[model samples]
Target: MANFGRVIELTIDDMIFKMGTYAIEGTIPFDNDPIPNESEIKIWNLSPETIDRIKRGSIVAINAGYRGDVGLILHGFVSKVLTKWDGTDKITTVYVLDTDDISKRKVTDIAYAEGTLASYILRDMAAQLGLPVEQFELNQDFKYEDGYTANGEVTKIISDVAADCGTSAYVNKGKLYIRNLRYGADDVFMLSSGTGLIGSPEPFEDEDFKGFNLKSQLQYRITTASVIDLNCRRFNGRVHVRKGSHKFSATGDFMTEVEAILP
Candidate 1:
């Protein structure tokens, strides 16, 4: 990607809004946690009718990149919309969550028979929530000998099932995914000076994991659990993304920050 001429397209319900020359600002964050990802976007100066269309619960999809390389970065329901005045500019901010309608719904008195596969239980939970399955990979499909009962919030239930199977479950781009922490997506993104690598990747360590913090020209393709082939002055190898954020603004801020660990 050339990393020139910023392009952003926001789709709200049936209406579409495009911005190339205008200012668009927002932050989109993703991770491997059980909860859905939330995004906050700000657009400057819109008509009253346009603002009216951006009500709560409206479907929203945001795509951005340099000119012709645009791609989907966020897809979810609008959780909130607020408009305010900044001098002569009227800014509208929209909050979105990447989960389906059943995020708040509860599963009551549902039980699975003994010897049931963990994958089947997860699929049924997803079906109940109306969330599509994007990727489901489990290293061990543990079978419950005493059977299983599903209760509480759908998100929690799904998380519990994943824990029993020794995996993690999360929603990405409005779809559900289950995988072990040691694994990630098969596709690899190369990051170097030529491919928008900003500076030397800084090394950090925690109690459980040690990884690098990376900054590069906004790369929309990178997501939670995506593999990165890093080629830099200090470090050169592959790492799996644990969490990251894509941040953009018309005031010269456009980049992707990632915290990744060796897998």
Candidate 2:
């Protein structure tokens, strides 16, 4: 019982709740991928008091794994909640999507001079969504033409520019990160064989031909940030996280799988 207390720490709308067994599914966006990555959480037998706070648009953060503090597996706003009853038990599930979902709705139309720097334009777009810029390394010299219009969803404009520059842009933890494909080597987190890695990393072909030509799939017992390093053969040291899903249950166990690519 004591161990269970240390295994899962969940905060929803700044309020913590004790749950039976829970699971979270997440995916990190890259390239032309959708913004604000999506996640789903299933909680067992939640108290009425806790469920009341989980209205649509509430904030949620999760920390799980046996060693306890595994960092944030998923952070986003609640989209929907479903309640179910299985004979003598009650189950509640919450759906979540990163801030991008909310920001994408805010449409804007702004014109820039022919020589406007890409960084400045990006900053302006992000500001509309109240998201901070993490890195704006898109070619500074790259400029839009005179009478060019920056319009539509704020995230769409940023992503279109990133796609044009052969880079990627996405939102994580309420921050916008723009960088070259597979370029965050200095910040890579090491995943050793003894750690969460389940089996030998499997190689697969990427269905998104435009995104990348190669992909490596990994399964683990937990989920971390959107990016990580698979310290093994054929992974090219670091892989950009494309998608991840975590499924945890009190009676069964916890597991997370990630699909990544090299550049």
Number of the top candidate by lDDT? 1
Per-residue lDDT tens digits of candidate 2, residues 191-260?
Answer: 6555455556777674552222222222332222245656654453666666556655555545556666
lDDT of candidate 1 over 1-263, digit per residue (tens): 45678877889899877776456789999987668777998888988998998898999998877887879889989989999999999999999887655567788989899888888888888888787787889878989888989988988888888988878888789888888755854688899999988989999999878889999898888888878899998988988888899898865768899999986
- Model 2 lDDT at residue 77: 83
Question: What C-alpha lDDT does candidate 1 achieve relative to the native structure?
Answer: 0.85
lDDT of each: 0.85, 0.60
Q: Provide TM-scores for the models.
A: 0.91, 0.77
Q: Model 1 compared with the native: what TM-score?
A: 0.91
